[model samples]
Target: MTHHPTQSPQFFLTAPSPCPYIEGQFERKVFTHLVGDKAPEMNDLLTQGGFRRSQNIAYRPACETCRACVSVRIIADEFKPSKNMKRILRRNADLIGAMHDAEPTTEQYSLFRTYLDARHRKGGMSDMTVLDYAMMVEDTHVDTKIIEYRRRGPDSFITGKGQGELIAVALTDKMADGLSMVYSYYNPELEDRSLGTFLILDHIARARAAGHPHVYLGYWVEGSRKMAYKVRFGPQEHLGPKGWDRFDTEAV
Candidate 1:
Protein backbone atom coordinates (compact mmCIF):
# COMPACT_ATOMS: atom_id res chain seq x y z
CA MET A 1 0.00 0.00 0.00
CA THR A 2 1.31 3.45 -0.94
CA HIS A 3 1.24 5.86 1.99
CA HIS A 4 0.17 9.40 1.15
CA PRO A 5 1.64 12.28 3.14
CA THR A 6 -1.51 14.21 3.89
CA GLN A 7 0.17 16.29 6.60
CA SER A 8 3.45 17.10 8.31
CA PRO A 9 2.78 14.94 11.37
CA GLN A 10 3.79 11.30 11.79
CA PHE A 11 2.03 8.90 14.18
CA PHE A 12 3.41 6.00 16.16
CA LEU A 13 1.98 3.34 18.45
CA THR A 14 3.15 2.37 21.91
CA ALA A 15 3.70 -1.14 23.16
CA PRO A 16 0.85 -2.52 25.21
CA SER A 17 1.06 -1.88 28.91
CA PRO A 18 -1.05 -2.68 31.93
CA CYS A 19 -4.13 -0.52 32.06
CA PRO A 20 -4.07 1.83 35.02
CA TYR A 21 -7.79 2.20 35.42
CA ILE A 22 -8.82 -1.39 34.90
CA GLU A 23 -7.21 -4.55 36.25
CA GLY A 24 -5.76 -7.23 33.90
CA GLN A 25 -6.32 -5.23 30.73
CA PHE A 26 -3.46 -4.05 28.52
CA GLU A 27 -3.54 -0.64 26.89
CA ARG A 28 -1.76 0.75 23.86
CA LYS A 29 -1.74 4.26 22.41
CA VAL A 30 -1.27 6.07 19.13
CA PHE A 31 0.67 9.29 19.54
CA THR A 32 2.44 12.10 17.70
CA HIS A 33 4.70 14.93 18.79
CA LEU A 34 3.06 18.30 19.31
CA VAL A 35 5.52 21.01 18.32
CA GLY A 36 6.44 23.93 16.07
CA ASP A 37 4.24 26.30 14.03
CA LYS A 38 1.18 24.14 13.78
CA ALA A 39 1.23 22.85 17.35
CA PRO A 40 -1.73 24.81 18.63
CA GLU A 41 -3.96 24.07 15.63
CA MET A 42 -2.96 20.43 15.56
CA ASN A 43 -3.49 20.09 19.30
CA ASP A 44 -7.00 21.48 18.93
CA LEU A 45 -7.85 19.09 16.08
CA LEU A 46 -6.45 16.01 17.85
CA THR A 47 -8.13 16.85 21.16
CA GLN A 48 -11.52 17.09 19.47
CA GLY A 49 -10.84 13.67 17.99
CA GLY A 50 -10.25 12.06 21.45
CA PHE A 51 -6.52 12.65 21.82
CA ARG A 52 -4.98 14.10 25.01
CA ARG A 53 -1.63 15.81 25.47
CA SER A 54 1.15 14.79 27.82
CA GLN A 55 4.17 17.07 27.83
CA ASN A 56 4.87 17.55 24.09
CA ILE A 57 3.11 14.39 22.89
CA ALA A 58 -0.54 13.96 21.96
CA TYR A 59 -1.91 10.43 22.46
CA ARG A 60 -5.08 8.37 22.59
CA PRO A 61 -5.78 4.78 23.57
CA ALA A 62 -5.53 2.34 20.69
CA CYS A 63 -6.09 -0.97 22.41
CA GLU A 64 -7.22 -3.78 20.11
CA THR A 65 -10.06 -5.26 22.15
CA CYS A 66 -11.05 -2.68 24.74
CA ARG A 67 -12.73 0.66 24.03
CA ALA A 68 -13.68 1.62 27.56
CA CYS A 69 -11.69 4.82 27.56
CA VAL A 70 -14.11 7.45 26.34
CA SER A 71 -13.27 11.11 25.85
CA VAL A 72 -15.55 13.53 27.72
CA ARG A 73 -15.98 17.30 27.51
CA ILE A 74 -18.39 19.34 29.55
CA ILE A 75 -20.83 21.84 28.07
CA ALA A 76 -19.64 24.75 30.16
CA ASP A 77 -22.55 27.08 29.58
CA GLU A 78 -25.23 24.55 30.42
CA PHE A 79 -23.79 22.87 33.53
CA LYS A 80 -25.79 23.24 36.71
CA PRO A 81 -24.38 22.31 40.08
CA SER A 82 -26.21 19.63 42.02
CA LYS A 83 -26.99 19.99 45.73
CA ASN A 84 -23.90 18.06 46.74
CA MET A 85 -21.70 19.95 44.33
CA LYS A 86 -23.10 23.21 45.63
CA ARG A 87 -22.10 22.07 49.09
CA ILE A 88 -18.58 21.35 47.84
CA LEU A 89 -18.44 24.89 46.42
CA ARG A 90 -19.53 26.34 49.73
CA ARG A 91 -16.95 24.26 51.60
CA ASN A 92 -14.21 25.60 49.42
CA ALA A 93 -15.47 29.18 49.28
CA ASP A 94 -12.43 30.43 51.17
CA LEU A 95 -10.19 29.15 48.38
CA ILE A 96 -9.40 31.18 45.25
CA GLY A 97 -7.88 29.81 42.03
CA ALA A 98 -5.66 32.22 40.09
CA MET A 99 -4.39 31.45 36.62
CA HIS A 100 -0.68 31.81 35.94
CA ASP A 101 1.62 31.18 33.00
CA ALA A 102 2.87 27.64 32.48
CA GLU A 103 5.58 27.72 35.09
CA PRO A 104 6.73 25.16 37.64
CA THR A 105 7.70 25.75 41.25
CA THR A 106 9.13 23.75 44.10
CA GLU A 107 6.06 24.52 46.14
CA GLN A 108 3.81 23.13 43.42
CA TYR A 109 5.91 20.01 43.14
CA SER A 110 5.75 19.49 46.87
CA LEU A 111 1.99 19.45 46.80
CA PHE A 112 2.01 17.25 43.71
CA ARG A 113 4.12 14.70 45.53
CA THR A 114 1.86 14.70 48.54
CA TYR A 115 -1.23 14.24 46.41
CA LEU A 116 0.21 11.42 44.37
CA ASP A 117 1.34 9.57 47.46
CA ALA A 118 -2.05 9.89 49.06
CA ARG A 119 -4.31 9.14 46.11
CA HIS A 120 -2.28 7.39 43.46
CA ARG A 121 0.57 5.79 45.37
CA LYS A 122 0.59 2.75 43.11
CA GLY A 123 -0.07 4.55 39.85
CA GLY A 124 2.53 5.24 37.18
CA MET A 125 3.01 8.94 38.05
CA SER A 126 3.46 8.34 41.76
CA ASP A 127 7.24 8.19 41.36
CA MET A 128 7.62 11.39 39.31
CA THR A 129 10.49 13.52 40.54
CA VAL A 130 10.45 17.29 40.83
CA LEU A 131 12.14 17.66 37.45
CA ASP A 132 9.67 15.27 35.88
CA TYR A 133 6.87 17.38 37.30
CA ALA A 134 8.47 20.51 35.91
CA MET A 135 8.60 19.07 32.40
CA MET A 136 4.98 17.98 32.72
CA VAL A 137 3.99 21.54 33.51
CA GLU A 138 6.25 23.47 31.17
CA ASP A 139 7.03 21.27 28.15
CA THR A 140 3.86 22.07 26.23
CA HIS A 141 3.98 24.14 23.02
CA VAL A 142 0.34 25.11 22.99
CA ASP A 143 -1.28 27.79 25.17
CA THR A 144 -1.09 26.34 28.67
CA LYS A 145 -1.53 27.61 32.23
CA ILE A 146 -1.42 26.61 35.89
CA ILE A 147 -4.19 27.57 38.28
CA GLU A 148 -3.15 27.75 41.90
CA TYR A 149 -5.82 27.52 44.57
CA ARG A 150 -5.28 29.11 47.95
CA ARG A 151 -7.08 30.84 50.75
CA ARG A 152 -8.40 34.26 49.80
CA GLY A 153 -6.09 36.99 50.94
CA PRO A 154 -6.87 40.53 51.92
CA ASP A 155 -5.97 41.81 48.45
CA SER A 156 -7.18 38.80 46.48
CA PHE A 157 -10.00 40.62 44.72
CA ILE A 158 -7.65 43.24 43.32
CA THR A 159 -4.67 41.00 42.56
CA GLY A 160 -6.64 37.89 41.63
CA LYS A 161 -4.23 35.84 43.73
CA GLY A 162 -4.52 34.18 47.07
CA GLN A 163 -1.99 34.41 49.89
CA GLY A 164 -2.40 31.47 52.21
CA GLU A 165 -1.15 27.90 51.77
CA LEU A 166 -1.53 26.29 48.38
CA ILE A 167 -4.42 23.87 48.49
CA ALA A 168 -4.71 22.77 44.88
CA VAL A 169 -3.31 23.23 41.37
CA ALA A 170 -4.57 22.42 37.88
CA LEU A 171 -2.40 22.24 34.76
CA THR A 172 -4.63 23.25 31.87
CA ASP A 173 -4.37 23.98 28.16
CA LYS A 174 -6.32 26.70 26.40
CA MET A 175 -7.59 25.50 23.06
CA ALA A 176 -9.56 27.58 20.58
CA ASP A 177 -12.71 25.71 21.57
CA GLY A 178 -12.21 25.13 25.32
CA LEU A 179 -9.91 24.45 28.24
CA SER A 180 -8.34 21.00 28.45
CA MET A 181 -7.53 19.94 32.00
CA VAL A 182 -4.23 18.15 31.54
CA TYR A 183 -3.70 17.28 35.18
CA SER A 184 -4.82 18.39 38.62
CA TYR A 185 -3.66 17.75 42.19
CA TYR A 186 -4.82 19.01 45.53
CA ASN A 187 -4.06 18.80 49.25
CA PRO A 188 -4.91 15.21 49.93
CA GLU A 189 -5.30 15.96 53.65
CA LEU A 190 -8.36 18.04 52.87
CA GLU A 191 -10.49 15.12 51.81
CA ASP A 192 -13.59 16.76 53.20
CA ARG A 193 -13.21 19.67 50.82
CA SER A 194 -13.57 17.48 47.75
CA LEU A 195 -10.92 19.54 45.98
CA GLY A 196 -10.89 17.32 42.90
CA THR A 197 -14.56 17.96 42.25
CA PHE A 198 -14.10 21.58 43.23
CA LEU A 199 -11.38 21.97 40.62
CA ILE A 200 -13.69 20.74 37.85
CA LEU A 201 -16.47 23.02 39.08
CA ASP A 202 -14.06 25.94 39.00
CA HIS A 203 -12.91 25.01 35.49
CA ILE A 204 -16.47 25.06 34.27
CA ALA A 205 -16.90 28.56 35.68
CA ARG A 206 -13.62 29.70 34.19
CA ALA A 207 -14.44 28.32 30.76
CA ARG A 208 -17.88 29.92 30.82
CA ALA A 209 -16.42 33.29 31.79
CA ALA A 210 -13.88 33.06 28.99
CA GLY A 211 -16.73 32.35 26.50
CA HIS A 212 -15.44 28.85 25.84
CA PRO A 213 -18.21 26.35 25.28
CA HIS A 214 -16.50 23.27 26.76
CA VAL A 215 -14.03 21.93 29.31
CA TYR A 216 -12.26 18.77 28.31
CA LEU A 217 -12.08 16.26 31.19
CA GLY A 218 -9.94 13.64 29.45
CA TYR A 219 -11.02 9.98 29.31
CA TRP A 220 -13.87 8.54 31.37
CA VAL A 221 -13.99 4.77 31.54
CA GLU A 222 -17.44 3.41 32.40
CA GLY A 223 -16.42 0.58 34.73
CA SER A 224 -13.74 2.48 36.57
CA ARG A 225 -14.72 3.95 39.90
CA LYS A 226 -11.88 6.39 39.52
CA MET A 227 -13.58 7.89 36.48
CA ALA A 228 -17.17 7.86 37.70
CA TYR A 229 -16.97 11.38 39.07
CA LYS A 230 -16.59 12.77 35.54
CA VAL A 231 -20.16 11.86 34.69
CA ARG A 232 -21.51 14.16 37.40
CA PHE A 233 -20.64 17.26 35.38
CA GLY A 234 -23.28 16.58 32.83
CA PRO A 235 -24.52 18.00 29.58
CA GLN A 236 -21.22 16.64 28.34
CA GLU A 237 -20.33 15.19 24.95
CA HIS A 238 -18.44 11.93 24.37
CA LEU A 239 -16.29 11.27 21.34
CA GLY A 240 -17.41 8.16 19.48
CA PRO A 241 -17.37 6.43 16.08
CA LYS A 242 -19.74 9.04 14.64
CA GLY A 243 -17.96 12.00 16.26
CA TRP A 244 -18.97 13.86 19.42
CA ASP A 245 -22.33 12.82 20.82
CA ARG A 246 -24.42 14.00 23.75
CA PHE A 247 -24.12 11.92 26.96
CA ASP A 248 -27.27 11.60 28.98
CA THR A 249 -26.87 11.09 32.72
CA GLU A 250 -29.68 8.54 32.72
CA ALA A 251 -28.07 6.48 30.03
CA VAL A 252 -24.78 6.17 31.85
Candidate 2:
Protein backbone atom coordinates (compact mmCIF):
# COMPACT_ATOMS: atom_id res chain seq x y z
CA MET A 1 0.00 0.00 0.00
CA THR A 2 1.23 3.46 -0.81
CA HIS A 3 1.88 5.56 2.27
CA HIS A 4 0.51 9.06 2.06
CA PRO A 5 1.69 11.55 4.64
CA THR A 6 -0.53 14.30 3.31
CA GLN A 7 -3.34 12.32 1.74
CA SER A 8 -6.37 10.54 3.14
CA PRO A 9 -5.98 6.95 4.25
CA GLN A 10 -7.95 3.98 2.96
CA PHE A 11 -10.41 2.92 5.63
CA PHE A 12 -12.07 -0.46 6.10
CA LEU A 13 -15.22 -1.28 8.05
CA THR A 14 -15.47 -3.99 10.69
CA ALA A 15 -18.25 -6.53 10.82
CA PRO A 16 -21.05 -5.95 13.26
CA SER A 17 -20.40 -6.87 16.87
CA PRO A 18 -22.45 -6.66 20.03
CA CYS A 19 -22.21 -3.24 21.60
CA PRO A 20 -20.16 -3.39 24.77
CA TYR A 21 -21.64 -0.24 26.25
CA ILE A 22 -25.22 -0.20 25.00
CA GLU A 23 -27.56 -3.17 25.22
CA GLY A 24 -29.50 -4.46 22.17
CA GLN A 25 -27.25 -2.55 19.84
CA PHE A 26 -24.42 -3.49 17.52
CA GLU A 27 -21.10 -1.74 16.91
CA ARG A 28 -19.13 -1.39 13.73
CA LYS A 29 -15.85 0.42 13.19
CA VAL A 30 -14.25 2.23 10.30
CA PHE A 31 -10.51 1.85 10.67
CA THR A 32 -7.18 2.28 8.93
CA HIS A 33 -3.72 0.94 9.64
CA LEU A 34 -1.26 3.28 11.29
CA VAL A 35 2.03 2.24 9.75
CA GLY A 36 4.96 3.45 7.69
CA ASP A 37 6.84 6.72 8.20
CA LYS A 38 3.67 8.76 8.09
CA ALA A 39 2.02 6.79 10.86
CA PRO A 40 2.54 9.46 13.49
CA GLU A 41 1.26 12.25 11.28
CA MET A 42 -1.67 10.13 10.15
CA ASN A 43 -2.43 9.19 13.72
CA ASP A 44 -2.50 12.85 14.72
CA LEU A 45 -4.85 13.84 11.90
CA LEU A 46 -7.18 10.90 12.51
CA THR A 47 -7.19 11.61 16.23
CA GLN A 48 -8.32 15.16 15.56
CA GLY A 49 -11.04 13.62 13.40
CA GLY A 50 -12.13 11.50 16.39
CA PHE A 51 -10.33 8.25 15.61
CA ARG A 52 -8.77 6.20 18.40
CA ARG A 53 -5.54 4.23 18.04
CA SER A 54 -5.36 0.58 19.10
CA GLN A 55 -2.13 -1.32 18.55
CA ASN A 56 -1.33 -0.69 14.86
CA ILE A 57 -4.85 0.36 13.95
CA ALA A 58 -6.94 3.52 14.30
CA TYR A 59 -10.73 3.18 14.46
CA ARG A 60 -13.98 5.03 15.12
CA PRO A 61 -17.60 4.05 15.57
CA ALA A 62 -19.44 3.44 12.27
CA CYS A 63 -22.69 2.09 13.58
CA GLU A 64 -25.65 2.11 11.20
CA THR A 65 -28.24 3.47 13.58
CA CYS A 66 -26.54 4.69 16.72
CA ARG A 67 -24.56 7.87 17.23
CA ALA A 68 -24.29 7.70 20.97
CA CYS A 69 -20.57 7.10 20.99
CA VAL A 70 -19.36 10.69 20.84
CA SER A 71 -15.68 11.51 20.84
CA VAL A 72 -14.79 13.58 23.96
CA ARG A 73 -11.70 15.63 24.69
CA ILE A 74 -11.14 17.74 27.75
CA ILE A 75 -10.08 21.36 27.21
CA ALA A 76 -7.09 21.11 29.45
CA ASP A 77 -6.02 24.75 29.52
CA GLU A 78 -9.50 25.89 30.56
CA PHE A 79 -10.42 23.06 32.91
CA LYS A 80 -11.07 23.62 36.58
CA PRO A 81 -11.42 20.84 39.12
CA SER A 82 -14.66 20.48 41.02
CA LYS A 83 -14.80 20.32 44.81
CA ASN A 84 -15.06 16.53 44.67
CA MET A 85 -12.20 16.32 42.22
CA LYS A 86 -10.13 18.47 44.54
CA ARG A 87 -10.85 15.97 47.31
CA ILE A 88 -9.74 13.07 45.09
CA LEU A 89 -6.49 14.86 44.30
CA ARG A 90 -5.92 15.50 48.00
CA ARG A 91 -6.60 11.86 48.79
CA ASN A 92 -3.97 10.70 46.31
CA ALA A 93 -1.49 13.37 47.38
CA ASP A 94 0.87 10.74 48.73
CA LEU A 95 1.17 9.12 45.31
CA ILE A 96 3.24 10.28 42.33
CA GLY A 97 2.95 9.45 38.66
CA ALA A 98 6.11 8.85 36.66
CA MET A 99 6.08 8.83 32.88
CA HIS A 100 8.07 6.08 31.22
CA ASP A 101 8.67 4.81 27.73
CA ALA A 102 6.06 2.46 26.30
CA GLU A 103 7.42 -0.80 27.61
CA PRO A 104 5.60 -3.67 29.28
CA THR A 105 6.60 -5.52 32.45
CA THR A 106 5.35 -8.41 34.56
CA GLU A 107 4.25 -6.08 37.34
CA GLN A 108 2.05 -4.04 34.98
CA TYR A 109 0.53 -7.19 33.54
CA SER A 110 -0.25 -8.50 37.00
CA LEU A 111 -2.02 -5.29 37.88
CA PHE A 112 -3.82 -5.36 34.53
CA ARG A 113 -5.08 -8.87 35.10
CA THR A 114 -6.20 -8.04 38.61
CA TYR A 115 -7.96 -4.92 37.40
CA LEU A 116 -9.77 -6.78 34.62
CA ASP A 117 -10.83 -9.62 36.88
CA ALA A 118 -12.18 -7.19 39.44
CA ARG A 119 -13.76 -4.56 37.20
CA HIS A 120 -14.12 -5.86 33.64
CA ARG A 121 -14.63 -9.59 34.07
CA LYS A 122 -17.12 -9.78 31.22
CA GLY A 123 -15.40 -7.27 28.95
CA GLY A 124 -13.54 -8.27 25.79
CA MET A 125 -10.05 -7.77 27.22
CA SER A 126 -10.69 -9.79 30.38
CA ASP A 127 -9.24 -12.94 28.86
CA MET A 128 -6.10 -11.33 27.42
CA THR A 129 -2.86 -13.01 28.47
CA VAL A 130 0.43 -11.40 29.36
CA LEU A 131 1.59 -11.41 25.76
CA ASP A 132 -1.61 -9.69 24.74
CA TYR A 133 -1.07 -7.12 27.46
CA ALA A 134 2.45 -6.52 26.18
CA MET A 135 1.16 -6.00 22.65
CA MET A 136 -1.41 -3.53 23.92
CA VAL A 137 1.32 -1.41 25.44
CA GLU A 138 4.16 -1.85 22.95
CA ASP A 139 2.60 -2.46 19.54
CA THR A 140 1.69 1.13 18.79
CA HIS A 141 3.52 2.92 15.99
CA VAL A 142 2.77 6.43 17.20
CA ASP A 143 4.29 7.99 20.28
CA THR A 144 3.05 6.31 23.44
CA LYS A 145 4.00 6.38 27.11
CA ILE A 146 3.15 4.38 30.17
CA ILE A 147 2.56 6.46 33.27
CA GLU A 148 3.01 4.56 36.51
CA TYR A 149 1.37 5.77 39.67
CA ARG A 150 3.21 4.81 42.83
CA ARG A 151 3.46 5.85 46.42
CA ARG A 152 6.03 8.60 46.94
CA GLY A 153 9.24 7.56 48.64
CA PRO A 154 11.76 9.78 50.42
CA ASP A 155 13.75 10.47 47.25
CA SER A 156 10.75 10.92 44.90
CA PHE A 157 11.21 14.70 44.65
CA ILE A 158 14.76 14.45 43.45
CA THR A 159 14.20 11.45 41.17
CA GLY A 160 10.98 12.90 39.74
CA LYS A 161 9.67 9.38 39.53
CA GLY A 162 7.58 7.34 41.86
CA GLN A 163 8.71 4.53 44.15
CA GLY A 164 7.17 1.52 45.88
CA GLU A 165 4.15 -0.50 44.70
CA LEU A 166 2.31 0.52 41.51
CA ILE A 167 -1.22 1.62 42.23
CA ALA A 168 -2.36 2.77 38.78
CA VAL A 169 -1.20 2.87 35.17
CA ALA A 170 -2.18 4.98 32.17
CA LEU A 171 -1.41 4.06 28.56
CA THR A 172 -1.27 7.45 26.87
CA ASP A 173 -0.46 8.80 23.45
CA LYS A 174 1.32 12.10 23.10
CA MET A 175 -0.79 13.81 20.46
CA ALA A 176 -0.02 17.08 18.68
CA ASP A 177 -2.83 18.96 20.41
CA GLY A 178 -2.80 17.16 23.77
CA LEU A 179 -2.35 13.84 25.53
CA SER A 180 -4.69 11.03 24.60
CA MET A 181 -5.52 8.61 27.40
CA VAL A 182 -5.85 5.35 25.51
CA TYR A 183 -6.48 3.27 28.60
CA SER A 184 -6.02 3.40 32.35
CA TYR A 185 -6.33 0.84 35.13
CA TYR A 186 -5.99 1.09 38.86
CA ASN A 187 -6.19 -1.05 42.01
CA PRO A 188 -9.89 -1.78 42.18
CA GLU A 189 -9.72 -2.15 45.94
CA LEU A 190 -8.69 1.46 46.40
CA GLU A 191 -12.07 2.85 45.53
CA ASP A 192 -11.83 5.81 47.88
CA ARG A 193 -8.77 7.27 46.17
CA SER A 194 -10.57 7.33 42.78
CA LEU A 195 -7.44 6.53 40.86
CA GLY A 196 -9.26 6.68 37.53
CA THR A 197 -10.29 10.28 38.04
CA PHE A 198 -6.86 11.13 39.36
CA LEU A 199 -5.27 9.78 36.21
CA ILE A 200 -7.42 12.07 34.05
CA LEU A 201 -6.57 14.97 36.32
CA ASP A 202 -2.89 14.24 35.96
CA HIS A 203 -3.23 14.05 32.20
CA ILE A 204 -4.81 17.49 32.19
CA ALA A 205 -1.94 18.86 34.21
CA ARG A 206 0.56 17.16 31.93
CA ALA A 207 -1.14 18.58 28.84
CA ARG A 208 -1.17 22.11 30.21
CA ALA A 209 2.46 21.92 31.25
CA ALA A 210 3.35 20.76 27.75
CA GLY A 211 1.40 23.67 26.23
CA HIS A 212 -1.21 21.33 24.77
CA PRO A 213 -4.84 22.37 24.56
CA HIS A 214 -6.84 19.17 25.02
CA VAL A 215 -6.75 15.67 26.50
CA TYR A 216 -8.62 13.08 24.53
CA LEU A 217 -10.72 10.72 26.66
CA GLY A 218 -11.96 8.49 23.84
CA TYR A 219 -15.72 8.07 23.41
CA TRP A 220 -18.48 8.86 25.86
CA VAL A 221 -21.82 7.14 25.26
CA GLU A 222 -24.99 8.74 26.45
CA GLY A 223 -27.09 6.50 28.74
CA SER A 224 -24.21 4.10 29.10
CA ARG A 225 -23.69 3.82 32.83
CA LYS A 226 -20.13 2.71 32.20
CA MET A 227 -19.34 6.06 30.58
CA ALA A 228 -21.37 8.37 32.80
CA TYR A 229 -18.30 9.29 34.80
CA LYS A 230 -16.79 11.07 31.78
CA VAL A 231 -19.32 13.89 32.03
CA ARG A 232 -17.76 14.96 35.31
CA PHE A 233 -14.82 16.49 33.44
CA GLY A 234 -16.46 19.73 32.61
CA PRO A 235 -16.04 22.06 29.60
CA GLN A 236 -15.12 19.15 27.36
CA GLU A 237 -15.45 19.35 23.58
CA HIS A 238 -17.53 16.71 21.87
CA LEU A 239 -17.16 15.97 18.18
CA GLY A 240 -20.54 16.73 16.68
CA PRO A 241 -22.10 16.95 13.24
CA LYS A 242 -20.89 20.53 13.11
CA GLY A 243 -17.39 19.81 14.33
CA TRP A 244 -16.10 20.23 17.91
CA ASP A 245 -18.52 21.95 20.26
CA ARG A 246 -18.38 22.78 23.92
CA PHE A 247 -20.51 20.43 26.04
CA ASP A 248 -21.04 21.85 29.50
CA THR A 249 -24.31 20.86 31.15
CA GLU A 250 -23.46 23.09 34.07
CA ALA A 251 -24.03 26.07 31.80
CA VAL A 252 -27.66 25.11 31.27
- Which predicted model would earn the best lDDT? 1
Model 2 misplacement above 4 A: 1-8
Each candidate's lDDT (Cα)? 0.93, 0.91
TM per prediction: 0.96, 0.96
Using alpha carbons, what is the TM-score of model 2? 0.96
Q: What is the lDDT of residue 97 in candidate 1?
A: 91
The window of 10 residues in a row where model 1 has the poorest summed lDDT is 1-10
Kindly report the root-mean-square deviation of model 2 from the true structure over all alpha carbons.
Answer: 2.0
- When summed lDDT is taken over every stretch of 10 residues in candidate 2, the lowest stretch is 1-10
For residues 129-224, write the lDDT of model 2, one tens digit per residue: 999999999988889999999999899999988888889999999988999999999999999999989999999999999999999999998888
Off by over 4 Å in 1: 1-7
lDDT of 2: 0.91
